[model samples]
Target chain A: MGPITGEQIAEKLSLTRATLRPDLAILTMSGLLEARPRVGYFHSGKFPHQIVAKKIQSLLVADIKSVPIVVSEKCSVYDAVVTMFIEDVGTLFVVKEGGLLEGVISRKDLLKTTLGGQDIQKLPVGVVMTRMPNVLFTHTEESVWSAAWKLITHEVDALPVVRKVAQPDGSDGYEVVGRLSKTNITRLFVELGEGN
Target chain B: MGPITGEQIAEKLSLTRATLRPDLAILTMSGLLEARPRVGYFHSGKFPHQIVAKKIQSLLVADIKSVPIVVSEKCSVYDAVVTMFIEDVGTLFVVKEGGLLEGVISRKDLLKTTLGGQDIQKLPVGVVMTRMPNVLFTHTEESVWSAAWKLITHEVDALPVVRKVAQPDGSDGYEVVGRLSKTNITRLFVELGEGN
Candidate 1:
């Protein structure tokens, strides 16, 4: 009646009991789920439907308040911190000659860059910036899952939700705007399933 | 003032403006984003982040639920449907005996198993299932972003969030509950940025 047991799992998977145990052990150690003695496995069921949705949105960078404090393609770490704070964000979407989303600079990236014993005053954010090749981005309209996918694969917290739009000067197209880490999906899930 | 001009993006992304045109066209057509030919690019500021999250979550099944339903793994398709509905989920977490997580089954898997000349009453969900060695999962307590990443990188929709814990016999641990699709993350973000 409860969750299927490990024994049940083995039968269902068509694998010998011995092989699957180790795999299960690794999972158990991570706290993703837990098992009871004889009763069977029980899901925490913490993250409900709504919370998952919220976490996905928080990672978006579009419509975020602008921080004009960032003066250059390479700004001071001091100024980067200021920009993030003023914008009430943890990361910054770095741009170049046009409004295209060039790269990203997070408080962590800036701090990590500075911690490397680099000259703070002379260093441009570009030096510490996660360049285009190194960055993970989503279109301004990618599904939350798509964005989440980029974050997880890139091992970063935010994604530049860029948009490729036609040019006014009779040029071609370009990217603009970005999405950053806006919410913790797990936390939101946990909260939604709180009362249930 | 509006989205960064295409010229800016070309310089920053290091790509020719022509090459990027298709991606822009596709994004706009897909309704994931919007654009202004002369002004700039813009998202609807109304994409249902939660629904999008749900759609993505639907893709993260590490196991196939349809197998059991099709094969009548000791039950009826009606029962399987009930299980799916009760869990408020569309996929079933497949497992092996001894509490190890196996492949997962989604509605698509079920339907596929019963497709064409296949008979639902006699088929096992496993037959049409996306099987092991290709299944993706998440660790217990992994970050939402990281978990979402696994779903994305692997092109999946859900993860069986597993963990290890005392097995009542005071032994070691085992795999347990699934985190599945995290819908809450998207929901929260959309609500917080309603009509943005």
Candidate 2:
């Protein structure tokens, strides 16, 4: 039916209009149906899961990103590990003067370097870090769902949230703004479960 | 108003009953209002977020847990790291005969040990792992929301999904069954966003 009145639906189902009201209300509220003023109801062409997807996608990274833990490219791998411990973060952005992101280092990278039997005290993190253009990142304006997708598809524990900045060389550089991580996603999941 | 009819609500708002149907349906469907046959609508005493929370809380850990990556207690830290790399997991469960959980080890724990300048190749993972009775764990029947909450509260990357088994000594032992990690939660978040 293009549009069906409440009374017509109630009559078709052999239900009183009052008994049918809640059912129609549920369908409309869940976006499975749309009711027009004086025109009755029809399919909205949207599924119930789309409501959840829309809610999740509407959340921006800026709303939930954690403070970015940063280290200098010249920082020794030993110091980088120490910083990671002190900051209690899985990933750290390698930043230069003015907090411009140069690269990103993760616990996995440091662990692999440690297992290599190299002198961590002498090796700078820059050598082991995933350098710019190779580093996967997100912007504040991006949706949290998109960031989470990137984290999953790329198999990285975290992404540096950045803002574009015009560099002295006339190319664009990312200014480290925050961090989006699996931890943040887990926390958000908990929050959603809590009805927050 | 208790058990007010749609016509009464429409009259109160100076709108036709046809125009008021969708609004009432939204309120009733979101669980803020209850509709009963011949009784009209009444307050449900429920918040909208509760609907989302209930859906999330009903998801069980067994439905989404990943296969557990385990190692024996005598396994060296070097080999444990290698297993972690090969399995592509962040945490490893230390188990013994019958697949019982002995302890849990994380990349963070291994990284800290590496920085201590110890002989990782000779250091048994058992020496560095968070041992039994101290490890926080989850079971197959536990809700995913509760498991995610533990991940955030305990600041651990993963939790071993275990089951209680009666030991020969009249004690309870936990058999490692699966793994629940922040990665799982992130993946779930993406799945929800995709409306799957």
Candidate 3:
């Protein structure tokens, strides 16, 4: 009911304790399941199928921005690169003074723009990112599958999950919450697939 | 089979021929099904699940570089924004004069760094864009699915589809090619699911 143990997992799937080791190794390395020695393997309880990846759900954009990271709107392209290295992240979220959702920047986006050999210190990141029209988003509680689908369809990476906190025209203030990616699904899947 | 005609499709699927028009329109727009002026609908005959986006293709890095953009490892952060606007790409690829890949930049990355007002314009992109310990590459022959998988697994937006055009150490030489994104797959899927 709560979490599946390694012994229980091995019994359910009919895999030998020895053969199961390899898959277990892969699963653990992939961040799917965790081995607890005496506790067996603990499932993170995060298995996602293609169905979940494509289903849309409600989201809060502010929740995502809440994660402590540098916030910017008009910095030099050079500065963006530095933050990426310092933070060790592939994507960065851009917001206004009020944390109004602006756009996003990713490693690929930066790489593509930097290839031009323009002065990085002089260039504004705004010139390079997939802007307003190109950005895809989701509501909090939206299906991971839906968020994933948007990523695929938009031909872009990462989706800002926002909840209508207070729409200016309406009564909602769009806020970014959780950031969803396919990696999350894969991590969950690997854990469930290899119970060893 | 050769191809499915509109009448045949309508009859076989039990849907009115007229009703199927919208789905057909979407499929064609996504570059999956081909229509030869009422020649019915033929599969794109490219990637399997061509109608549904089963396999994703690789990107040629060289082709991306050939798109006519400017990059600068040493330029001030302010100039990068100008290049991004002129290029009309969501991201940029950073590499050396000899075509060796370096780092990446995205709109969000720049936005975050600049928001705090740390004199980003004088900074080099090398200061903010992602550096080592976080780069992933894909070979030319690998399916787009593989690249997609990497994006999902690594929580990144894109992959450098490289071909070993020439390997100095005989390890591998990958020339970047074609860009594949989630949008491509999402578009294909919307069409595939259109069927009743």
Best by TM-score: 2
Model 1, range A86-178, lDDT digits (tens) per residue?
565556777766676666786556544543545666777777777776667666455555555555445565566666766778754446454
The candidates' DockQ values read 0.03, 0.39, 0.05
TM agreement with the true structure for every prediction: 0.33, 0.83, 0.40
Write one digit per residue (lDDT tens) for candidate 3, span B131-160. 533557665455545555665676564555
User: What is the C-alpha lDDT profile of model 2 across B89-168, one tens digit per residue?
Assistant: 99999999999999999999999998898999999999999999999999999999999999999899999999999999
Return whichever of 1 and 3 wins on TM-score. 3
Window of ten residues with lowest summed lDDT in model 3 chain A: A50-59
Question: B1-196, model 1: which lDDT tens digit per residue?
Answer: 1364556555554668897566555444433336777765544332334334433444323331112212233443334444655554545665555555555666434433322334444555555555655666665445554565555456444556666656667864446455555343443334433322
Residue B106 error, candidate 1, Å: 39
Q: After superposition, which runs of candidate 1 have C-alpha atoms over 4 Å from their true positions? A: A1-71, A166-173, A182-196, B1-196
Task: Give the alpha carbon lDDT tens digit for every residue of A1-196 in model 2.
Answer: 3787887676654669997777677666656678999989886755445666767888999999999999999999999999999999999999999999999999999999998998999999999999988999999999999999999999999999999999889999899999999999999999989986
**Per-residue lDDT of A7 in model 1:** 80
lDDT of 1 at A160: 62
**In model 2, what lDDT does residue B95 have?**
97
Give the CAPRI rating of model 2. acceptable
List runs of model 2 lying over 4 Å from the truth.
Answer: A1-43, B1-47
